[model samples]
Target: MSSPAHAIYSSTLSLSLQGHAFHPQYGVQLIFNEIAESLILCGAICSQNPSCRTFDYDSSSHRCRLFEADLTNGAIIAAASQTSIVGSVILSASLYASMYNQSCSACQENRYQTCSSTTNTCQCPGNSYWNGSMCPLQLFENAACSQIDACRSDLNLSCIINSYGGFTQCLIGINLFTIFVYENTKIVQIETMSDYASLRSNDGVVSPNYNFLFDENILE
Candidate 1:
């Protein structure tokens, strides 16, 4: 009866090797007794056991000790012969960077391909864009786009016909500000505005009384 968040949290579990040895008084559950030859084998042993969460491997004696849970109650000490192996999947702020780094690998079989830690998948380089199954050539900013989907949506760009040349170009729309004088009078100053609001101008109280255009929707 695990929640969706719990299922997501459980997937990040991994095995890592710590430099120091586990505490002597930690009292491991002893899943396998003195049979592990290498640290990798010890990790495999821990993975097989349902209760094993952490383990300590002794390089000198080849003593493999497995713990049922985390070793918060135990203290880590400096030991040259023993190596501690942790099977922690618990999500915490301190372990976020390590977990993120562990999630990334040389994109499946391709070493040159980009790897996304969030999706945990291989992706094309900057020159290409993902097209459902595979990545295709990415459209440049000024490239001609005849179709609506020709432009790259990730770059916040769109394809439209140019005003001056009448050619389709991948471009981004920007707000333009222009000043216009109404009735050719120095008493009033006005500028073009958009859907938000217009800036009010003060002309030193010189009212040259002219007809003003007001929209009822603007007041509302």
Candidate 2:
């Protein structure tokens, strides 16, 4: 293989798996593939592409494959050949600014909405929820929630009052079941779905003071 031209290794890349390679599975997609004489050449090619998030370099074949894959997007299976290395780009680095050279649609100049490294669109900075047209401020998925919109809008989670009695509206003749809530104002424990039909068989009073909260993660 011919040696690759001397190019400065950009500080925006990080090695994920050394001496390891991955092949596309059934539904995997790739940005492009090319003959790369060295690992540096493979990474340089990935840096040149805006959508290239990962790259795999095969030492024996002198080939490189660029992909939009990432740890959160999905996992790639390892190949039988162990003479390769895999690297991923840092989304939060200055490289992102250069990657998104083109202007994003509907992105206001001074709205604090930056370009999303994953979606390549204009969205709220630091994982804020984007509501298509604009980024609406929202709480984290694992944080203490109070209102129905407490969690990220993308998650589409239901708001259940923790430490409350039970969901009176959840029960209907034979089609519905009672959902019991906890009584702790500051719910620090995980709440499970408890269905009791006998307790409130008929019309029951709904508690006015439904406070405390529990996310879908802690619910079973």
The best candidate by lDDT is 2
What's model 1's TM-score? 0.30
Task: Give the Cα error of residue 96 in candidate 2, in Å.
Answer: 6.7
lDDT agreement with native, every candidate: 0.42, 0.46
- As for candidate 1, its clashing pairs are none
Residue 159 CA displacement from its true place in model 2, Å: 19
Using alpha carbons, what is the TM-score of model 2?
0.40
Off by over 4 Å in 2: 1-11, 23-28, 93-220
Model 1 whole-model lDDT (C-alpha atoms): 0.42
**lDDT tens readout by residue for model 2, 9-119:** 332677756566645431334768889989988988886654466788888898899875565444555666677788876644232232222345443332234554544
| C-alpha lDDT of candidate 2 relative to the true structure | 0.46
Model 2 Cα shift for residue 76 (angstroms): 4.7
Clashes of each: 0, 3
